[model samples]
Each structure stands twice: as structure tokens, then as C-alpha cells.
Target: MTEVVIAGIGQTRVGEFWDLSLRSLGVRAIRAAIKDSGGLQPQALYAGNMLAANLSRQAHVGTLLADFSGLAGIEAEALEAAGASGAAALRQGYLAVASGLVDVALVVGVEKYTDLIGPGVEAALATTTDSDFEAIHGLTPAAQAALLMRRYQHEFGLPADGLAGFVLTAHANGAGNPNAMYRKAITLEAYQKAEMVSDPLNLFDLAPNADGAAALILTRRDRLPRDFPHPVVQVAASASVSDTLGLHNRPEPLWFAAAQASVEQALKKAGLSREQIDLFEYYDAYSIYAALSLEAAGFAARGQGWKLAAEGESGLQGKIPCATMGGLKARGNPGGATGVYQAVEATLQLRGQAGANQIPDARCALIQALGGPASTAVTHVLKRAD
Candidate 1:
């Protein structure tokens, strides 16, 4: 098998894009990525999207984007796996290149949640859960996260301010990212005073749905042109796992077992330990999710994840720096596009191009994407090609 490497990365600012259509957002990122990769022509294009049909009333999105982007003859398809759709698409691209089936693969994750997209986004998100059992009872993502937050505090004897640091850190880092949606850092007081979306899950605890797209070009390491200017970022490992979709069916509602399993497998495949990761790009769809991810990924002891933030251990100078480019919170969760955004951001760090948010000497990064409250987790470990 060949080694898969990311040769290019691109993204649109995460926010409401009332001016651009879905295809337009995708084309911008795809074109940018192609340009970044020294204009490598992709043999295939894979789209990661969740709400094109439900919200945008458009399907066959892969063909549409490929046609619009002037790659009409390339093999194209769309892959969906809830919020982890982007990672799923990336996984496919990785396999395609690693298996020597495609010389160049383009993976693009895009989502539209504003303007004329209609009011079905929330309903569409609910599809990630067990519709018959969970959505029918109005167990929205926020409410589900609140339940976990409340239980975590009660179980750990924590105060209401436990998650405030997580929000603060994300905002502070996001402030330096021009592409972030919430660029203004928040004070502890503001986090505490923010209106509640769900009890125990205030507005700050959740990442709002936005519109964005991120793209990457993947090819075998040996296939990279000798003249390619940028440093290579190899996909050392890609792993995925799944559990019951409904929170009610989970053995431990607060523990993200899938995240733990997927990340553990990916790390093992990469011949690395948790301590070897220079940084992490976790799915922080909610504050509770961030805490759970930290614990599940072995960044902190169980029930001690929140303490990392409380102790200022989640900052840029902390032991395990996270959310370096705002994460899903301040960077804005652009639905299925979020996973690709994580990849693009991680690539920037690995390439030493993250600007103010860059981690000094960052050589390895672990990126994880969650689907439907940890029901599914896709993890990838990337290493700077030496």
C-alpha cells in the first residue's frame, strides 16, 4: 500500500454565506486547494455533506460541484455520515490514494445553513439520532449535551463554572483566526451571563450551525512531484468506530466510547502514543463534547477533562493544546464541513502556516470528528513528512 499524504488544503471563512450558493462555496475551496497543490488535477472528487437535500433541496451535489468547478469528467460522489461526513469523505480519499487506485483525490466538505436554505437544518441534524425514539421525544443536540453536562457536574461534584474555561480558550484562540466566526474573545463573566439554550448548556456551550467549505488534495507520498514546494503531511493513520446512535442506548452516556476506540486504533496504527501528539483537533460541537473528547482521547483522566481547562492546561501553552484555530465552537460548526475544516486547520499547523494560531514546532496532530453525539468517531493521525 502507498502512503497517503495531504498535498493541499483550503477553506472558506466559517459563517453565514448569504451571497454564495452551495456549489460556489465548494468550488472556491476546491479551486483554492488545487492551486495550493501546484494545480494538481484530481482523478476523483468526493464531497462530504449532510443537508444538501434536506435544507438546500439539492442532491447529486458531487456532480454539481465537479461540473461547476470544471472537473466534470472526474469520478465524483458524495459521502454522508452525519456531522462526520467530512471525515468520512477524507477517509475515502485516503484509502483511494493509499490503495493506489487514484493518483490524486480531492475531498471537499461543505454545508449551508443560512438564508434561503429553509428551516429544516435542525430537523436534518436530528436525523443523526434515532428518529423514532430520540427525535420523536425532542432530544435535540443541545438538550442531549445539557443532559450530559448536568450529569457530569453532578457525578464529579463540579461547579457551574466548570466549562467556562473551555469556552474562553476557544474564543481567545479564535480571535486570532480571521476565518473564525466568533473572533472576539469572551470573559468568564460573559460566558456565565450568556443566555441558556438548554439548562446547563448556555449559548457558549454550543457551536452554532454556519455555512462553510473545506477541501484537501491527497496523493501517495512517493507520487508527490519532486518540485512540490510545501512540506509533505502524511496520513499516518485513519481509523473509525461506531456505537448506538441514540444516547438512550449508550452504555455510558457521558463517555465517548467510539472516540476512545477510534483514536486508540489510529494512534496504534501510526505507531504513536497519546503523549506523542503535538496537538489535537477534536470535535467540540458542545462544551460537554469537548470535555468528553479530552477524556476519551486520553488527554485527561476520566472526570478530570474539565479540570484541564480550569487549570489553564488547554491554552496554547498548555500540556495538550487544543482548539488552536477555534475548533467547532468559535470557528463555527459548519455541519458536515466541520471535519474537513479540522483537517485543513491541522494541515496549516503541520505546514507552519497557521499564522498567529500556529503551535511552535508542531510536528504531529491528531484530528477527530464526531457524528451524532459520539455515535460515530473518525480519527486521523498526521505526521510532518521528514
Candidate 2:
């Protein structure tokens, strides 16, 4: 198979961009990635979006973004796997380049949550879950997560504040990420007193919905300039695994079986154990997810994932630095654009461009994206070119 390298990366700050249209946000990232890649034009475009048709009332995002970016005739189409849309699109671009069918593949993850608000936004988000089984009964993502968190706590006999450390760590890390939406650190007391959004899922427990776009340019290593100025970052593994969509359908509701499988497959492809990962950009859309994902990725023992955060083992200088540029929690959940943001953030660390959030001597990075309670789990391992 041909090698796939991330030649360039770009992203807009994660926040409410009421002024920018969906395509406008995508164009900015596309242009920036192109410029970053030294003006390499893409032969294909894979747009990752979840709510263009639902919230923005626009479809054909791939062609719309391609035309807006002045690359109208490329092989363009949108790919969606709920929250994993961005990583799904990136995986497609990786495949296209890896198969030698496309020299340069452009993958863009864009979403404009501000286009709709209040009930509309809530309704749109609910679509990611099972409409008949989950959403039909008014179960939203936060509620779904709340149920999982409650079950996890009951099974593990955890305290009410068992997961506070993840929030603190994300906010503390976000303080160093200019692109993050919530850059200020919050005190433990602040988190404790924060109002609840969904039962046990407090305001601090869930990531706020936001608008943003992130892009990456993937090409064969041989196609890059002989003297590429930056350190080379290549896609070591791309693995996606899916499980039952409805929560009730699964025998184990909170296990994140798909995430575990995806991580295992990604690690196998990269020829490294989970311990070899320098940093992990996990699917921290919710606080409970960070805990569960650690276990699924083999970083922590089952039901003990929360202890890693409590013990500060997830800090920048600890066992496995995570969310180096802030995660969805502090970065603001950019709907479908999140997975691409993970890719961009992980690429930054691998290239030594993470600034204050940089992990010491970082080289290998593991990034995962979730699509509704791990129904669609996408995992990727990135490595600095030796």
C-alpha cells in the first residue's frame, strides 16, 4: 500500500460563528490547508458534516464546499457517521490516497450549529441516536450519556464527583490552546456547583455545541517536496468499528465495545501497544466518555478509568497525555468537525507545534472519534516520520 502523509492542516477556532455560513467556514479551512500544503490542489474532496440537511437546511456539502473553494470538478461528496463524520471523511481520503487512486485528497469537517438554536438544535442532535428507540422517547445525547454515567457509577460504586478531574484537566489544557473555545480553567468548586443539564450530567459534564471547520491535505510521501520544511507526519493506522445503534440493543450499554475494537485494530496496524502511545486525543464529548474511552483503549482497567484523571496520570507529564489542545469538552463540540479537529490537534503535537500543550518528546499519537455512544468508533494513529 502507498504511504499517506498529512501534508497540511488547518482549523477555525471552535465557538459560535453566527456570521459564517457552513460553506464559508469550510472554505476558510480548505484554503488554509491548501496554503499550508504549499498550494497542493486536491484531486478529491470528502466533506464531513452531520447537520447540514437537518439544521442548516442545505445538502450536498461536498459539492457546495468544493465549488465555494473553487475546486468544483473534483470527486466530492459528503460522508456522515453521526459524530464520527469528520474522522469518517478523513478515513475515506486516506483510502483514496493509499490506494494510489488520488494523489492529493482533501478532507474537510465543517458544521454550523449556530444556524439553528434551542429546540431545533436539540432536535438535530437527537438525530444522531436511534430515532425510534431513543429519540422518539425524547432521549437526547446528554440524556443518553447521563444514563450511561449513572450506570457506570452504580456498577463501579463511584462518588458523585468521581469524574471531576477530567473536566479540570481539559480546561487547564485548553488554557494553552488558542483555538479552544473555553480557555479559562475552572476550579473544582465551580464544577461541583455548576447547574445540571441532564440529571447527573452537569453543565460542565457536557461539551457545548459550537461551529467550526477543520481540514487536512493527504498525499503520498513521494509527492511531497524533497525538502519539505516541516517534520513529516504520516497516518500510521486508520480503523473504524461499529456496534448496535440503539442502546437497548446492546448487551453491554456502557462498554464502548466498538471503541475497544477500533483501538485494538488501529494499534495492531501501527505495530505498537497502547502503552507506546505518546498522547491520546480521545472522544471526550462528555466527561463520562473520557473515562470509558480510556478503558476501551486499554489505557486503564475496566471501571477504573476515572482514577487516571483523579491521579493526574492524564496530565501533560503523566502516563498518557490527552487532549493536548483541549478536547471536545473545552474545544467546544464542533458537531461533525470534531474528528478532523482531533486529527489537526494530534498532527500539531506530532509536528512539535503544540506550543504550551506539547507533551515532552511526543512522537506517536492516538486519536479517536465517537458517533453516538460508540456505535461508530473511528480510531487513527499518527506518527512522526523517522
Leading candidate by lDDT: 2
Query: Model 2, 7-92: lDDT tens per residue?
Result: 98999988988789999999999999998888888999998999999988999999999999999888999999989999999999
* Residue 90 shift from truth in candidate 2, angstroms: 0.6
Worst 10 residues of 1 by lDDT: 115-124
| TM-score (all chains, Cα) for each model | 0.98, 0.99
Q: Which segments of model 1 are wrong by more than 4 Å?
A: 116-119
Q: In model 2, how large is the Cα lDDT of residue 307?
A: 94
* Cα TM-score of candidate 1: 0.98
Query: Candidate 2, which segments miss by more than 4 Å at Cα?
Result: none
Give the per-residue lDDT digits (tens) of candidate 1, residues 1-386.
Answer: 68889998989999998899899999999999999998889999999998788778899988998999999999999988888999999999999898888999999999988844443666777777899998888778778889999999999876898988889999999998889999989999998899988898999999979999999999987777789888889999999899898898887898999999999999999999988899899999998888999999999989989999888888888999899999899999988888899999999889898899989989999999999888889999989988
Clashes found in each candidate (C-alpha, N, C closer than 3 A): 0, 0
Model 2, CA-based lDDT: 0.93
Query: In the order shown, what is each candidate's alpha-carbon RMSD?
Result: 1.1, 0.7
